[model samples]
Target: MQLMEVCVIAKCTYKSETIMFSVSSESSMVDILKTLCLRFRGLQLGCFTLRYSVPSYPSCFLETDSDLDLMRTFLLISNEKTVDILVKDLCGISEYSGDFCVNKELIACEKGESSCSSTVEDRNEFLGRSKRASAKPLLSNEWETYIHHVGQKFDGGAEEFRLKLCKYALEVGFNFLYAGNDKKRVVAVCSNKKLEGCSWRVYASRCEATGSFVIRTLNNVHTCAGRIRESKSKMMRSRVVSSLIVDRIRAKPELKPVEIIHEFKDYYGIDISYYHAWFGKELAKLDVHGDESKSFNELVWYTDAVKETNTGSLCTLDCEAGINRFRRFFVSFGGCIAGFQYCIPLLFIDATFLKSKYKGQLLCASGKNGNQGFYPLAFGVVDSETEENWTWFLQHLASILLPMGRVVTFFSDRNQGLLNAMGFVFPGWPHSYCYYHLKQNLISKYPKSGYGKLLQDRVINLFSRCAYAVTEEEFKVAMEELVIVGSSKVKAFISDLSRDHYANAFFKGMRYGEMANSLAESFNNWVGVFRDLPVLPLIEGIRQKLMVLNSQRRFEAEKWTTVLCPEMETRLCENAEAGRTWAVRRSNSTVFEVFADYSVMVDLEQRTCSCRLWQIDGFPCTHAVAAILAKRDSVYDYVECYYKTDFFRKAYESPIFPIPDIGKGLGSNGSAAVVCFRQLQRGQPEDHQQRGSKFLFVVVKVDGILNVGVDIGQAFNTRRF
Candidate 1:
């Protein structure tokens, strides 16, 4: 066996010493232990273990022969020249024994002269180093791990020190207050100082040399009971709470006050009031997204920024008479306006309530893309859902869509204000009423107690059948059934409504199979989370959502390989399958006779069938499908151009640019001084007056443009109330 030089290091609570030894490669654990005991002289009296001094493998204990062999193999593989072993005390009793102390010096002298080749000078050099220097405490960045001591240094001045002290006192479950506070110094003491004479105190002063605060005196011994100190702590204020929950609020802005209270109680073992949590959350929100009141003022800059970045876009702001008070605001992105040319011409108009500090109404005009997806055309915020407001919104919409020369249809519930507005703005256009809303009105008009709900359901079903009927004869049959079962009032109500608005057979414009304004409802639900924000943020949020929707749809449309959209293709395929059993007879190149349950005439040239489904739905119906298949023609050719993949791509090709941050280069030095309108006082209770006043200080820097008599129409096209 080959011999190797091994260095054995012994460590205890008081001292550490090293000695050299000559060992054979075949040495076992027992052999090494016996040699260590004989050489150290103190190991014979107490429990100890031998471990390899490999820093990477600190717990490699050599307790058996296999452990010794593993250590040797590891050392050989690691190419270590010297074999280092650590002798650790297992019982920690022998290092302090008088006998061990007397034998340590004798063993050192013997080893100094032995053939192991370790000298007394080398031993003294290792033992002369201070133990405190080797075990110095490390500084921690976490406040929970910080320990206060005299002469400790902090980077910031009195404010930073006070903040850290508050956090530290809270972490340790103790109450503290400032005994002396100023810009140059801060002195904190236990809150129980007057009652119990608690000695816990920390005094920090600004250092003249480094301009940082340094702890001049610290007496960390507290004499008060733990319960009293923890229960009476006043360190948990709104400022501290804001600092603690700022990051959480930034990640989830919808976090409620009750959730914050529960989080503090469960996580920090502290109880807080609802007001503190709410105020803290408000402060954090201000830090994250700015003040809600100021966000209203940012609207002017935001509108200008949107117009500058997105060319051909229209943004108008309306103010009350004689004062710069906000009344209504409207925005229509250029991309959405340009893209509407490729979407379905039918617009679903609706209004939803805003849930902000200053409550308002959100009027939306949404369309359907080629794939039957919701496409928002334009939206605006108004003071209320009145006829005048609706008329103003429709005027802006007309300015965008009327120039396109396309025959558009308006679909919505029969809200009186909306109906009146539609009549005033687009008098010649076709407006369809949602049959669902009409049925709801009927249900409300006739209570279930008069005749059970079953009768109501039957009446609504018969009316729905009439609305869905394909021809005048079918509608007449459905109406006869309804009249036989319905009361005289119900019959009168149904007769008063125009059949051209609800009945599919009499509708003058193509409805595209839509019977309700579900698209606007969907848009409302999509932006529901952001409704609580102020006016500017709500508008910006909608813009961001539309931007993402357009980009995502454009990317998805790029990957489509079908000639028509997937929805239209599926509809065409289903119609072809249904018509498989039907027989077709050719009349001419453009005319054919399809025989099924009832014979229908198909005109391929007009893209219509006698059943009326093909022309109304913008696709080949069952009869038309049979006739087209008989002629060996493709069904996709008869589908409307709006349902083509090329049209879908065009609908989402325009990009919606991001609006830059407000107040970038803009200042509030202009002559225009805008304020929030106090319109809620008209019909609201006294308690709502404060919420109405939240919209404040909407100052716009008109510069010299408005003063120089620029046409108000050319500048803003705004309607003054």
Candidate 2:
């Protein structure tokens, strides 16, 4: 049987709709009713019945297949190409009841009224209807250029239309309020419509055919004396402003509220209050990065994800017992742990304040790479920088470092709690104090007004000379000068502090020319912008930075042809140039004496020079370079292994994998152990704090973990690492 198209008109008390469906001779009333239920949402199969409509015949229900067949046959006999049917509700009486009459002459006149040869205005009206049927929502970038016009259509329903209308009002320097607002219809008028006789208004209703909101009438002209001030307008809400600034906030998360106010005044010629701008900025940040409170709850999943993607990574989350509130978090990536073995055997530790809602401190441990670049080892977040927290952090750090059986030296500023923690955790390890901090402390004790600026500079310069002196005689000469410049109080202060911590000559361990904890300070400055973020995003941001740094350095190292890094190679060249005119006397194959202004001994076997520069800096000094030239050996070969290109490659070989976003509802495929602790109450001292419970974690990796378990999908795959 040939297929035929029929229009089924469904009517109710609220509204009416017409839907077209294809049917054949085999089609039954049951099939037609099923199709109608599917087409019209919220409709049930047994609640409505189809009725045949004809001008001459009595209106009757098409109840069975035979009735439908008879109706089709009658239509065919009458030479009609279309059949009109009505759907009536079974429970309630439909308004289209009783005899349904059709006037043929009236229908012919209506058809003639809308013919192709109609006037230009009528044809434009028909085209507007067609355009309204297929309208799309405006894009984010198109809002600046979009114009509000009569008969404009929005396919995103009433809420989107209201947002666009509000934006239009702000752009055109007018304010409006919704006179009548609902799901199906909306009416907006100027705020000064009644008082000032402003004629600006807009009316929109949902189209039954297209299910879109179309602007049926709009009066865009306003007769007001001046533009409405956005600062005084009720329509300039924080949510509306957030919608306008979300893209900018996402691009630069550190955009301040004051900057937003200036941007609005300069770009949009609108003035916004400070509080509204601040609240709007907060809302935009919340939209860009999820809620901060909810992010705390996601720590468990984030920890598991970190361990899964980057194997051997150590991530711990400490929360309050029973309350489940976050207290502390620590993370040490596998790549960093593996890479630190190739860096210098010295660590710079420091603590900085976190600018988040729940104020805390960020403790970091950094190392110096072969090229004198910053190498982050581990970091933790705690309530404050207390001895207990420092001890806890050091204990975890020991788990990674102690296994290598290499003696490491620590460098840091003088913090009493940190010093005590260092003594408690690693009793025999050598610790170096920052000379810069020591000099600041000495200057702080004496009043600048009493000593005068010139005397203070003289004392500090002598103190620096004493700290950098290579021989005992030189140290004595510098210390005597410092005492003469200052007073006996300065000598007493110097005597109280240990020389092994800051003085280069008396230090027990090799510092490799690093006298201060500047590496940690550099790291703190690098993550300054992220300190204000929540705990999870702050850590994630640091991880992303490290990931990019490693990848970039690794690629740059691949193109190198020199023995040492570029920086170390240049230093070696400068040393060789400085000692070119010196005289060299060889005592043996390993020992030599180089004479410039004075004579110094250089030993190749021990890799040391009497000047102490070669042994302390891990490279050939001027005297050693001159002796090596006398022996006709290359200076690059005499350089330490740590300064070679191979070690630099090893430091950044392992990759830091990207963590999956928890907002997408991705589950973890690996298991994690979370330790819980109860934070100390306010006014409580840290000395009385107790320990938290710890758990053992097991590692598990499942096949297709990235695809099924923690897949961020295509959205995160395109993001730069």
Candidate 3:
């Protein structure tokens, strides 16, 4: 409620529109603008800044927390009251139409100036004289009635109510009485009177954010603080700058201290120390996310809400009542069913650090879809990436994965935790170590000198080539090259790791050809900023991204011209071109011999070539291409089902149902019978689903769910839901 400096404006105008308000000359432009933004959805608040144009000086933004009177002096334009809100950072703000600007004309008027609006010379004098306000001294019951009415009109967030209270005190000649719990409550008393124990107090009653707030008027002074003072210190405490910083962090919790310091300084011209900025950031979080420890307490409710609303979503939280009360948490959308079935069966596992107040590790299990991009299947939050933690993660993963077999493969870095965990959960299942991590580990272990630098580069290059080699012969040649110059330690490292796990040549036909954990690594980096937030916020952020990704990928799939995805199509074309030089002899309609440096028998019936490229990789190998050319086979039929656009569409067909805000009650389609099935393509609850007549139900994609409705051909079928 404190105005530090005073301004007396001559005139006001906005060249664009005629906007009217309950005028108060004493009110700061910031307060007016904020009130306007709240009322008008058309106002792009954060994008634009208030600016004042003057005759002698060029037009500039109003950067300080200054009052209207002080700002008017700098205005050289005829209409000193008018301020332009110059908008910047225009991206995605408008989707359906072009960029639009609203022009507002603020006319300067002297007739309605509040008595509190004072000039520099008489500012303190006016405020000092009018510091206290008079209220019709009322009984306790009447005061309570008045408080209730005030709360009804301005009932919202505590901060918003705080602003309203400041305005009310200024209007009614009262001041903050000050009382118990200064952190949460604002108590206002008669400013006209001296600080006393029996002053009538108007208390802001903050309730659970979803509900309305009530202002309570108390007669008794069970708890009271000294009367409020009008000074720089008082102004600093109740100023909009702190609240603005808090709002910024609430919008983007990932903002760091440096960013906070810079933002505060740049906008307000007030230099805050790193610690002050940090304190502001923390305070902001407290307002936005509530208590850090309490967020953990809400995990159970949050997960239940998620599962109840999202249906097939997997949200599991495990806690142990030991020294470390919090243990592990894992969550995944039911859309994973589609991803696992229609996308490549390769899962990339990786762990990233959580930079929130409670430090931990984020373990992710992601798959590569037709577009060769990260298709996040599941995520786990653990105390650390230990064998036991990973085992817990993998064990839970096994639950949602459904009828797991050796057909599904996993890629991970050579972490002992993953090795041990995968060995237990997947036992005989094929596990591939990331080639990139292996090379990085090898390089780190064998630090080389000036001349050895070249050797180091060569060793890394050889290892990479070995992993990517087209055939066993090519891999063998690279191994021989490494042996001639490789160190004993490097050689031992290479020998210890299974070739089938890292080397493309050693891997048999059941291969997805994913030699690295790039899917998970890239996904981790994609959500790098979100990971810097609290557990719930991070998960919420990822969920939002997944929703967008599901829609976007499906949209992109709709535009594809070929049967296979763009990348697969491009790869097959390249192989087909290369196969032109190779000579092929037809043994039968479905069999052919491709003669190159070595003879590769291509069996069209089995869709496998002797070179194994056609089998390991979903795309047609050069040998397969040669046979297809000789046998006149359909190029479309050779590519794996996972590479097709239809499969890609199916991979992202189901929506990840949105979970409602924590206190907004259940979602629109939330139910109690509970969802034990995958998410539907539309937003409708299972209980609400109406059974239809004898419709053919065929499953083009096998997600282990027997959805027995919808017309289709040549796939698994069912009769009813």
Worst 10 residues of 3 by lDDT: 670-679
Model 3 regions lying over 4 Å from their true place: 1-242, 321-324, 404-406, 595-601, 665-721
Instruction: Report the number of the highest-lDDT candidate.
Output: 1
Question: Predictions ranked by lDDT, top down?
Answer: 1, 2, 3
Candidate 2 per-residue C-alpha lDDT over 1-721 given as tens digits, one digit per residue, 9 for 90 to 100: 9556543322211012356665556677667766776877655434445565543543456766777778777766776555545554332222121232122222223234534355566456435433543433222212322333345567877867887877666644577888999999999998888889988789998988878788889766577668733434566678767877999987777889899888776655557788879899888888776655555656777888889988978888877575454668889999999888898889999988776555578889998888899889898988777788899888888888998788789999888788999999888788999988889978876668754767777888988998899877888899888888788768888877888888887888888888888888899999888887777788888999999998999999898899899889889889989988999999999899999789999999899999999877777899999999999997777887778899999999998888766556533323221211233333355445433122111111223221111112212122111
Tell me the whole-model lDDT of each prediction, alpha carbons only. 0.73, 0.72, 0.62
Clashing pairs in 2: none
Select the stronger candidate by TM-score from 1 and 3: 1
Better of 1 and 2 by lDDT: 1
Tens digits of per-residue lDDT for model 3, 287-386: 7765444455456677898789777777887865432234578998877654567878888888887876656788998887887877888998875666
Error of 1 at 236 (Å): 3.8
Runs in model 1 deviating more than 4 A are 1-166, 177-189, 199-221, 227-235, 443-451, 476-497, 661-663, 666-721
In model 1, what is the error at residue 417, expressed in angstroms? 2.4
Q: List the candidates' TM-scores in order.
A: 0.69, 0.68, 0.62
- C-alpha-based local distance difference test score of model 3: 0.62
